[model samples]
Target: MSVSPRRLRAGALALATLAIISTTACTAGGGGGNANGGAATTLTVNTSFVLKTLDPGRVYEATGLTAVHALYDTLVTFEGSDVGTPVPALAESYEASADATTFTFKLRSGVTFSDGSPLTADDVVFSLNRLKNIKGSPAVTVSELSVSKTDDSTVVVTSATPNPNVPVVLAMPSTGVINAKVAQENGAKDGEDAAQGDTAQQYLDTNSIGSGPYVLKSYDPSAQVVLEANPNYWGDKPQFDRVVLRNMDVQTQKLTMQRAEAAEISLDISGKLLDGLPESLQTSGVQDTVYFLFLNADPAVSAVTSNAKFNQALRAAIDYQGIAALYGEGAAPGAGLVAPAFPGTLPEGEASTRDVAKAKALLAEAGLDNPTVTFNYPAITYKGVDLGTVATKVQGDAAEAGITLELNPQPLTTFLDEMRGGKSPLGFTPQSLNYPVADSLINNMAPGQATALRSGWTVQRADPAVVAAGEQVTETLDLAARATAMQEWQRLMNQSSPYIVLASNSSTVVATADLTGADYSAAGWQVDVAAVGRR
Candidate 1:
C-alpha cells in the first residue's frame, strides 16, 4: 500500500493515459500550482472536448461549459451541493416572502465585470428575462422566474408561484451574468428570438467578457485556450499567473505527462492504461467519476416506443455496478438519478436498484418481448473504459430479460446533438448537468419543462395534471411544501417515466507527492477551482 510517490505517480500517469484514450470528461476542473506560491498559479489541464464558444448562452454542452464557468460568474454561486441546494454567490443572501412566491436578493457590491464595468442589478434583470425568451435554449430553466430590480444593489426575483430553486438556477454556469454593455458589443444573441432565425454575431462565439477569476488570454478553437488570472477578481485572486490548455490526442497527452510537459493528467484514462500504471496507482489515492447510460425516449421518434414499461424494463435489465466494475477499482453503483452529494434528493425509495426478475417482468408487461433498441454513447477511445463492452454486456442482459438491444458509440458532438435534439429513440448519457439547486436537475427532465433539444420525450408534459403539480411545487417557498412537491414529482417520474438509474461518479484526484489541498466539497455541479491548492 505504501508505494513511493514515484511508483504511484507512474500508475496515476498510466491511468490518466487510459482515461484520455478511452473516455472523455464533460466539465473539466482540478489540477494546478502557483509556481512562486504567490496569488498567481498556472496549471495545465486536459480535456477531450474543446470549447466550441466562450459564450454561455450559445454553447451549453458540458465541455464548452468548462471555460464558461471560469469566464463568467453567476448571481448565486451554486454552493453547498451540486443537486440544486444553493448557497449565495453574487447575491449575498436571499429571503423569501411569507408565501415563498416572492424572493429578494441583496446584491454584492463593488463587483465589476472583467472590463472594469459595474455589474448592477439591471444586468441581472436583463440576463434572466433574456434566458426565458431564447426560443431554442434549455426551456425548463426559466419557467418559474418573474424578475425585477428594486435598486442598483437590490434585485427582487419572483417565481410564477412558490419557487425555491430560483437562486440555484441563477447560480449555474449556464446562467453566468453577462455585462449588458459587453454583451451588446459582442453581439450576444438574446434568447428571446433564437428560433426566429436571427443570426447573432458569430465573433462572440470565440470571445468572452464577464466577471471571473481568469480572463481569456488567447484561444485557437481546436487547439488550445490560454487564460490569465484577473488582477481585479472580486474575491481571492487566482493562484496561477497563466494556464495553458492543450488539445492533444489521448496518446500524446500520455507521453507528455511522463515527459513532464503536463504536471498532471486530468482526463479519464482507459483500462489498458491501467496496465501502464504501477500497482500503487490502483490504490485509494485515485478516484473515479461515475459513468451511466443516458436514454432519450422522445415521443417524436415513436409512440409505443416510449412506453413506461419499456423504459422501466430497460432500467431493470442492465447492471450498473457490474458496468462500473469494468472500469477499475474506484467505481460505485448508483440507485437514483440524483447523485448522493445532493441533499433531500435521492433517497433509497426514490429509485430502484438492479433486479433482473423485475426487468423481465416489466418488459413482458410492456409487451416488448424480444424488442431491439439502439443505445447511443459519447464516442470514446480510451483502452479500459470500453463503453462497447458495457453495451455488449447490456445486450447480453437484455437477451436474458427477453429484450434485444443494439449498441452505438459516437463522438461527443453527435451524442449531444442527437440527445439534446431529441431525435434519437434511445440513447444513454448522464444527468450530471446539475446545479446546486434540486430543481436544476428536476426541471431539465420534468413534465411541461423544456427538453434538452426537442427529443419530444415529455411524456409527463402530455398530461395536464402533471404540469399543474410541477407548477404548484415551484409556487411554494416553504421547505416542506417544496419537498412534498419534489416527492410527488419524482414519484410520478418513478411510476411513469423512469430512465435507467445509473452510477454516481466519484471524484478521484491524482497529484504529485508534493501536491496538497485535496479537499473535495460540493460547489454546484462544477468542480471547484477555488477549493484546489497544494497542501
Candidate 2:
C-alpha cells in the first residue's frame, strides 16, 4: 500500500471516528472530459504518498509502481484493465514449452527505447537477469526464472520447476525492460552476478532508461516527479504532453484539488473527505487494496505473539465490521489474503468475525490473562485511511477480550524498516495486489516469502500445508484446478492465523471534472497514465 504523510497534529483520530458515522453519503459521480471547457495539455496530479525511487528494479511500493508503469515497458502487459490475461507489449508473441518449464518471447520489430536505441532480445535478457541478480525486494518474484537470449529477436526463460504463471508474473512492473546500453554506460556495473553491488542505484533513481510512454524530465525525492511525453515511443502518443506527480499531505492534497491546482488527486481519501469535495470533481470506482494486522510468530523475537493460541485469540477478538465501517463505503471485511475483485479468491466466510467469549477462552488456554502485546503501526496514513485510528480500534477490541495492546506508532520510514526487519511484534499494514493470480497471494504468505518474513516466519518454521498448497497453485495450469487449490490454501492459512485481515477497501482516484479516461488496472493500485487525457 502507498504511504502518506504523518497524521494531523491533533484530533485526526477523532475526525476519523466521525467520518465513519457519515459513510452513507452518496458516491461521487464519474469523471468526464474537460467539462469546464478548454483543452489541457499538461496534467497535474497531487498525491499523499511520496516517491521512493524511479529505478524499476528498486521500486516495489504502490507510488513507485505507478511511475514505473508510465516509464517502462515489460515483455507482456495486462490488456484493458484486465490482469487475468497477458497481452503483447514489447514481445509480439510468446510460447511456453509442453512441460511448462521453458517460455520463449518474440520481440516486436521496429520498437525502440525512449533514447532512440532499437529494442532487441539482448536488452530483455539483460533486464531480466539484472532484476534477479540485483536481489532487491522484487527479485523474489522471478528468482527461479533464468533468462537467456536465443537471438536478436527471441529470448527464452527457463525454470527449474514446472511453473505455469510466467506470463502473469512478467506483466508486473518489476519485470519492466530497460535500455541496457544506457544503463551500462551510466552506472550499471555488475554483469549478472549477485555478489557485486549495484552501482546504478543512485543514477537510475532520477533517470529514465526504458521504452515507455513517458520520460523522466525531473525528479525530487521529497517533492515531485515531472514526466514528459516520449517522442520516440513506439505506441500511441500519450494524451497529455506532460505529467506532474506532486508530493503533499492529505490536507494539502484536498486544498490543491479544491483550488483546481491539480487535475487529479490519486490518494486514499475517506468517505467524509470525498463528501466534502466539490461536486465538479469525480471519483472512480474503488481499487483493490486490503488492510490487515500481521502477528510475528517467531518466539525468539516475540514470545507473546508467537503463541498460536494468543494469535488466534487476537484474530477472533477484532471487530471486523466496525473496522470496515471506518473505511466507509466500498469497503468490506476481507475474505482472505487475496481480494475478492480478482479471480480464484475464496468466498467470504465467518473466520474473521468477532467472538469475545471464544477469544477469552483461547487466551486463558494459552495462560494469558490480561497480557500486553506491543502493537506497532505507521504514524502516517496508508493510502487514505488513518492506520493510527485502526490500531486504536484494535486495541479497544482486544481489551474487551482481556488483552492489553500497547500501541507504538512510528514514522513511515522507520516503521517500514522495523517491520521489514522483523523487529515489530505485531503490525498494522495494508497490501495491494501485485497481480490478479492467486499465486500472487501465495508468493507473499508461503514459506520464505515476503509477507511471511514480515510476520517473522522463516523457512524452517513455515507451515508445511502452506508450502504444499503454494506448490499446488503454481504447478497446476488449469484455472479451475488452481481455484480449488487456492480455496484449500486459504482455509489452512486462516486456521494458522498468522495475519488477521480486517478489510479490503476500495481504492479511489479523484480527478477534476475535465479529466477522463483515468482507468485503473485490475490490481487497482496503478492507473493507466497514458490513457488519461483532458478535452
Candidate 3:
C-alpha cells in the first residue's frame, strides 16, 4: 500500500440503498447520540480515502484494507500494536512444521457468517486460493503458497520455501476469510484463470458475507461506505449499530469535529493542524510510515547520482533532524528503512546525523563541486503531509552544503510513472508496509526487488555481502538471529545504497475525547472501526 496519496476519481455512481441517518445530530462527532449522554447508535469517520474495491481478495490500498477488515475476519490477527505475535481468529489453534514449509489450522467451531451459515475449512481454502489465483496486487503476499481443506474443521497450507512468517502473512487484510458458498454463487472463481474469469468483484461491491463484526450496508466509490452490525457476528456485538466511513477532506473533517456536526474520528488530519484544536478533540499518534529519498543507480539516468561518492555526499548533507521536525510531534529520524515498530529495525541512535563538512569533503573527493540534480516528487499532500514542503526544506539544506537541487514536482500519476520506469534521477516518496513484518520492508531493497529495480539496482552492481545478509535475514526464522542479520543488512545499506531514509511520520487520528476505542495499529487498518465506541 505504498503511502502515495490516491487522487479523487470522477463519475463514480452510488448504490440506491437508503442511508441510516444519524440521530441527535447536535452532539459530539459520533452521530445519533443519546439525548442524556449515553451510547451513540452510529459512528461516523472522515478520511481522504483511496478506496477502489470492497472485495477482500482484490483490495490493496490502505482505506480498502480498513474497510475489508471490518467486513471479514482473517485466519489470524495481531492484538493492539503487538505485531510480533499473531493471535487466532477464525483458527482456534495452528501448528507449523519444523522446516517451516507446512502449517495446519484448526478452525473455531460454531462460528457463523453474516448470513448465519456455518463456517468451515472450505472457506479458508477458497479465500487463500482466490487470493493467489486472482493475481491482484495483494497476491504477492500469498505467493508460492497452496491451501487445502483437510476436513470441515481443519485446513493446511504449504509454502514453496521455508517461510517462518506464514502466520504473520496470513494476518494481512488481503487474506481475510470469505463465505465460500455465497462468493461462489456470486461468480467467484479460484482456478488459475480466475484473474480474468473471476466476476465476484462487482457482486462484492454491494454484498459482504463474512464472519466479521460488520456487514456492508452500501458503498459509493466517490462518496462513502456504510456498514451495519452483523447479527450473526461471532464476537461481542460492535458498539455502534451503524458506521459510516465517509470520504471527506481534512479541512471538512476538522470543521465537522469542531462544530460537532457529524464525523467523530478523522484519519487524515495533518500533525501540523492539531494546534488550537478544541478541548473536546483528542489525538493518538501511530508512527509507522517511513519516508525516504532514492537516487537512481542507472548511469543512463544520471552519471553523477550513480557515483557512490555523490550518494555519500548527499546523505551527509541532508539534515535529518530538520526534516523530522516538519512532520511535527511523534515523528522521528528514521532508524533504518524499516519502520520503527518492526522487530528488526535498527536502533534509534543509528539514525543519520548530518555533517555538512563531511558532505563538502565527499563532494571534493568525487571531483565534483556546484553540481545540480533535479529532485522529483508527486505534487500533492499525501496523507496530509505536503511533499513540496519537505522538498523545499531538503533543497535549502542541500544548498548549505554547496549542492544545488532543482525541484520538479509533477502530477502524482506522471511522477509515479517516471519513478517506476527508473526515469527519475532522484525521487522522494513515502512507503507503507503491505503487511506487518520486517521482511515486507527489507525485502523490497534486496537486489532486483521492487524498490531496487526502481532505483536501477541490480545484483551484479550490489555489494555481495549486503545481498547475502539480506538473504540471511529472510531465511532466518529465529527472532534474535533474524534481528542480528537485519542489523548487518541495514549497516551495509547505510554505507552504499542509493536510498536515504528521511523520517518516519506518525499517522494521527483525531477523535472526540469521549471515544473509548480510538486504538491504533501498524498492521491492518491504522484504526479499527469495529473497536471504536463511546467511553
Candidate 4:
C-alpha cells in the first residue's frame, strides 16, 4: 500500500501502527545500559536516513556523507559552525598561488590508514584522480582541479581556471582521502584502468579504509551501520568505543530517544515535536540548507510560467515570511540563491519580500487574471519542515493576488524524477550546498547549469544579463570582488524570477542531555564523532 504525504509527516502514530503490523522488527532496541549494571558507552543515533554507500567518492547524499565524515579525513575541514573558513585536516599546511589556480598541500607525517599504511602524496593524488575518473555526482568537487604528487609528503592541485574557493570545496566529505593501496587491492579501478569496469564499488560500498577516528564495522543499507574506533587512528580517539547508526522511521526514533535507547536523533523532526521533548533532549547547531520554488521559464514547458509578468506575479505573491515561520527558529526568508552563511551572498536589504499589490498588477499586465498553474512538490518534509505546507501557503497567497495554483504533491522519488527531468512546470525543491561556497549555488541553480536545464531554462532562453553577471561572479578571484559581482547577479536573478527563494534553513539534530560535542558545520554532515562525549 502506498503511503500518503500527511501520514508520512505525522510520523509518530502512523509509524507505530505500521511497526505493529509489519513482520520484520525494527532495530530500535540498542544503546541501553550494560548487562553488568554499568552505563553503556556505545553511542546510538536514530535517524530516518537510508545510507547509499560507504565509499567516499560515490557517497553524495547527506546521510551517507555524514558517515563518510566520521570515517575519513579530507584535505581541509571546517570546525564547529564556521562554514566559511577551511582548516587543515590531512594536509598539515597549504598555499595557493597569486593567481589562485594552483594549490600545494603538505601532508602531515605519521598518519596511517586503519590498516596502518602510511599516508603518502601518491595516495592523495590517486584518491583525487580516481574520484574524477569515477564521474559521480561528487566528482564536481574536484572536477576542475588537477592533482599531482610533488613529493612523498606534498601534493599539488592546479585548477583549469582561477578558483579561490578550492580549499572550501575540498572540505566536502566526498573529497575524503582514501587508502590507495587498500582500494586497489580491493578492486578499485583507476585512470586508464577500467578495462573491465570499476569492480571496487561493491567492496567499498560496505567497507571503509580511511585514516579517521572510526573504522566501518559493518553496513546494511536499509537497517544500520556499525562503526568502531580505529585504534591506529592518528587523531584523537572518539569518546565512544562503538557507534551505531540505525535507519528507522522518525516515530521510532522519537520513541527510542524517549526510552533512552538512543543517545541522539538526527532525523529532520519538526520544531513542534522537538519542543515537546523533555528538557534533557536538546537541539545542536544548524546546517546550511535552503528551500525554494523554481518556475520553468522555458515557453515550451508552460507559457504561463514562462511569461516574465507571470513569474514576477508568482514571486510577489509568495508569503515568504509565513513559510519561514513554518520552518521554525533558525530559518530566515532566503536572501539570494546562496545562503547568508556563505560568502558572496546578498545582504538583507537586497532581498525581495512579499508585496500583494505588486503581484496583482503584474498578473493584470500579463493578461493572466485567475490563471492556473500546477505546483509540484515532494510529499515529505525536508530539513524537518513539511514542504507541502510551504506549497499550500503559496497556493493560498497566490489566489489572493488573482492567481490560481493547483497543488500536485508526489513521493520524493517520483517528484524528483519529474522535476529533474524537466517535466514539472513548477516545483518546490531544496538546494543543499555540497560545500559552503557561492559558486556551488550559482553553478547548480543559475543559467547554463543542471538546475537550469531541469527547470527548462535552456541557454537560448536564459537572460543574457543574468548569464553575463554569472560569468563575472565566476571569474572574479578576490573574495570582496566576488561578493560585489554576486550582488549584480542576484539582482538580475531576482528580476527574472525563475526561482523564488522560500527560506534558508539550518539542519537541526536533537540529542540527549548528556551527549555533547556535535559539530553542525554548514557542509550538512560534518559531525565530529571524536568530540561527542558524555558530560
Local distance difference test, each candidate: 0.56, 0.73, 0.79, 0.74
Runs of candidate 3 exceeding 4 Å displacement: 1-40, 261-263
lDDT of each residue in 407-509, candidate 1, tens digit only: 7788777876776676667665544433444544456666544553354646443455556656766665666567667666655555555345455444333
For model 4 the local lDDT of residue 365 reads: 91
Q: Positional deviation of 462 in candidate 4, in angstroms? A: 4.2
Backbone clash count, each prediction separately = 46, 3, 1, 1
Best-matching candidate per lDDT: 3
| lDDT of model number 2 | 0.73
- Give the alpha carbon lDDT tens digit for every residue of 47-116 in model 3: 7766777799998766778888898998888765567788999999999998889999999999999878
TM-score head-to-head 3 vs 4, winner: 3
Candidate 2: regions farther than 4 A off: 1-40, 61-63, 115-117, 187-190, 193-207, 261-263, 268-273, 285-287, 295-311, 341-343, 349-351, 360-376, 406-427, 433-444, 447-468, 522-525
Report the alpha-carbon TM-score of model 2 versus the true structure: 0.79
Candidate ranking (lDDT, best to worst): 3, 4, 2, 1
Task: List all candidate RMSDs to the true structure.
Answer: 7.5, 8.7, 7.1, 6.8
lDDT of 2 by residue, 1-535 (tens): 2211211110000001111111111211111222223564678776655356667776776567778888899998874345667799999999998787899999999988887889898888888888888888778778899998878999999987777778877888888898888888866643566437667866776678888888877766566667778878898888787777776766777777776734565554544456567766656544366787888989987888999899889888989989988876557776677766566666766437898999999998999878888888888765556788889999999999999999999887788888888888988887765556656677667767876887777667767877788788877876667877887887777777577788876655666766666544654235778778664
Error of 2 at 303 (Å): 7.3
Candidate 2 collision pairs: 34-514, 268-384, 287-507
Please give the distance, in angstroms, between residue 252's alpha carbon in candidate 2 and its true position after superposition: 1.1
Q: What's the alpha carbon RMSD for model 2? A: 8.7
Q: Is candidate 1 or candidate 3 better by lDDT?
A: 3
